[model samples]
Target: MLLEGSTANAVGSQTLDLHRTCTKASQIFSSPGENFIQNKDTVKYGELIVLGYNGSLANGDKGRRRSRLALTKRLKANGVKPDVIHHISTPLVSKALSNKGHHSISYTLSRSHSVIVEYTHDASTDMFQIGRSTESMIDFVVTDTAPSGGGSGGSAQSTISRYACRVICQRSPPYTARIYAAGFDSSRNIFLGERAAKWRTPDGLMDGLTTNGVLVMHPTGGFSEDSSPGVWREISVCGNVYALRESRSAQQRGKLVENETNVLQDGSLIDLCGATLLWRTTEGLRRTPTLKQLEALRQEINAARPQCPVGFNTLAFPSLAQREVVEKKQPWVYSNCGHVHGYHDWGFRKEKGGVERECPMCRRVGPYVPLWLGCEAGLYLDAGRPTHAFCPCGHVCSERTVRYWSQILLPHGTHAFHAACPFCGTWLTGGHEQIKLIFQGPVD
Candidate 1:
């Protein structure tokens, strides 16, 4: 959240407008040639730059202009802009180092109700005139539990609430390969940005600069570094969206072996501006439709004529004007017990196999395994649901399992899996279930 290199000058000005205009999952445009700075990376040839902030804006994010002006005036008074300036507040500079640019945020809001009796606030007799507000926000999460014998029939009633949320940013294509200096995702199927750099130290490059710089890296290509001679590893993926790097070290090593002319004296040195990087993309994959070919295919799909054969197609045709691109349809993967895998939109559940997901537990007859969503919470968190997975030892345990049991068994969202491996297996003990949105469709 810290920044270096420049002070924001127009704090309360067009910054709000910029924020309002900027949206999630859209690219910020810039013109050519200007040094369009983003994150810690300095990008030249940028005419305009979009700004983003990922996390929530705590009150600490806002600042008054007095502090900025004081530092700038001090720098000017001292005969020059200081190597660095303390926190400067301005929109232009803020846009340059936007939090949204590097990360994103998601939150859920819901409402529930609780009741309590409060004495009325009346100054006439020294009583207070306060009434309890029955409604407020509450968490929607529930864990399975055994129903204890009802104490009093009149237990105060409460409401369960629900809310919407998202966890990942819409990734853009063609990320530069250099951006992957940090690392890549293994299973989450997402990318992470690098952490901010320390600034203004004795060895720091921002010595007198007040504002901070941008940080960027890209990921692509094979996981190998050896490239053949004359073959560069720098390549772009489809749409030329992401830049990738590969290894030419092997080829580079080979070139060293081949005879070559070197006209440099023993003490000579050479300085180079930059070098071109060579790379291969998906276009080179086995017989993928080429760019030109795909275009032609689309045309054919639209303009082809029907043959004189009987055909009954009851397909749901969509209007070209209001088309929404969803991932291509695929069959929903499910367990024999009825746990549904993700699909495009609506989720289908069977009364038997569609049991809500829950955590691992042990039953007298078998092991308590997840059969549906909230399964983890069902057995372990005391979610009053079915006692699915069982133990081989012939025991059916329906008592509410505890959190420690979950930490010793399941890996959260992986509730659809058996509590214990069928064959020789290792248990994935760690963390409680993390709620995720899942969709499933009926079989065609």
Candidate 2:
């Protein structure tokens, strides 16, 4: 299904843990902020900044130290204390950025919970890395010319470079809306709305979006004459969480209006031009639940109900007999034909392996899967086996199945990798970290 932001949010909230730690979904990445003083630069709040390679290394360690010292002075003037800094080796930074991927840098920052700044051994390049609004990180590489020397013993010339600083800010609730259109399914759902400074729609906004942003446009028509003033069109008002779906119904113009509000609830449904749009305000829809959270849910579900209500009776036993087998106490079920064998005189054929055995009556291959578990891989659980892992989408499976899905779903690019829950239809986009959480086992 092609996912509009509104529909995806509803599915996500319904499938995964709707109540989670608040995290930002929109990240702002840019070059260093403009300089405020003759030699000082300003830092913005909520930015975990990294100042890498602040000077030329023409004078070896002495020149490098001079550059760092100059950067320190500038930061002090700007009232920034970069105490949680991590110094990365130049070779590592080059290898990481050269690959044109975010995993290496994202892993570094998340694993350390700190910012990274690296100076090239040549002192000509500086690199900084930070987490994005999504479950990823952005890298900024700054390269400059080599420092030069003047007259008098070719003494090293002073090259002043400003360091970057970011003020940590508290995280607020995330606001995301998902819209769904006809012919869109769980596999094809992507945010499909135009981001506009005003009510103007880009010719290509409905064509497709390159990234996730606010989309505030009507589905099948141009600007309406009866729209509420200033709030006529759909708008994401509060941090993209709360939205205003405003329109005036003129029973004459065929314009229908319902559910009037500026705040977007967890799962709100909207109908526009035969298109069903579901609205939701969720935190980190692009991210998956942590392993700890998933395990806790599993524990809660298990503790609440110690055993499966259906128990062993629901399990299917393979019958190899060409004729139907009957038992008064225990009924026999055919694997291939699904014909339930009742109490009769004919004896049934027995199979060696449930999955490998074929049906004698229909001559069909093994119907090895069941309703509770979609695939044969999860058959072990039905056999009274204990499971150690569960997908963030809430599928309980063996650890091996989790590993297999992880390798299969590892992201190839920004939007290339994804996995869907067969039972719930919720798509997981947080990559291997999310998959790993699926297998990390419950907490102690």
Candidate 3:
């Protein structure tokens, strides 16, 4: 009934008597008359990793005695003695795992009952041998389970050791896909979703960091319920629609704002006012991957759905027939002359009439490049309006002498120039630097 050494590989092929083990363990781990092992069918012998440890203390609790006796008797009946007795704490687990002297480390199961028990031992060529037999010797597992439970044989206390290295082997891949942002292009205006490969999770349950491949696309209509029970919806990256969530909580995750829960089960689409689809993955949100695992979980549970879908350059809702105006529109360069003007296609005469060397009022000249350079400080003129283009500070100054002098005087100060930045009241100094650069080559 016992297994030892490399022969323990048979644990995958053995048939287990989980009913007997569960029944016995149920009595030991039970609280009074309640059977904590609700359903035994949830267990599979091939998946069991039974480890035992004798803690520093021992209690006279009957349940503890029962669990100890059960494990001891079972192993004794099977002619098995546990190969290793590890401390039931993080420090001990770390110490034990750090040592490379475990040559007897082998996974094995019972012949009569299918149950895997991780057998490990002191440094020796015959370390894995059970009762001196590397093939058939039965070994009793020395476990600290009973002592840690105050000899009550109840559920073990939660600790980093429990979830830290708790390994789960799956017949199927834990996740179905993997993806990463190969590149983000601005000139061409394209976002490439990991169109490279079909991503899959590791062979077993892994944190998002291990499977650091994911895409944060905006989903819509409602909360998306995952077929994977434990997996929840995460924000991944909150963009424009961050305010739309009706409510924000761990449970309300996967549910988009202003939509039903049943809608986005598998990712759907729906309208949500004039919102633009904004996306940034958990990876992008991260400056470092040290806490990528927990970070990924947070992303899934707080994912926001985009109110506005991409690909549709739109401003007004319900569709506009003629000319549509957006709340914030920028003026484009005329191309004929380096002037930042209305995006609207004005008649040639009209454009020419307005295309003056200077803004008669401000006296700023033409041949100017669209100055958003000042915007780096958060100042920019509302290209559609000639009024104050910067923040409420009223620092819009496009004059070169004034801007440079201001910056020199107040290094940290910002100005919101008409053709400037929004946050800081600074004029756009974009191409101005190039004009001052050395002329190394022939003049254009």
Candidate RMSDs in order = 25.7, 24.7, 27.7
Off by over 4 Å in 1: 1-217, 222-296, 302-311, 314-321, 325-349, 352-444
Candidate 3's displacement at residue 271, Å, is 24
Best-to-worst order by lDDT is 2, 3, 1
Ranking by TM-score: 2, 1, 3
Per-residue lDDT of 359 in model 3: 30
Q: Residue-wise lDDT of candidate 3 within 246-315, one digit each (tens)?
A: 2221112223332312111212111111000111122222321222332342233223211111111222
What TM-score, to 2 decimals, does candidate 1 have? 0.18
TM-score of each: 0.18, 0.19, 0.16
Please give the distance, in angstroms, between residue 271's alpha carbon in candidate 1 and its true position after superposition. Answer: 34
- lDDT of model 3, residue 377: 12
lDDT of 2 at 421: 37
- lDDT scores in order: 0.17, 0.23, 0.20
- Tens-place lDDT digits, model 1, residues 288-341: 223244334323422332111112111111222212222222112222222222
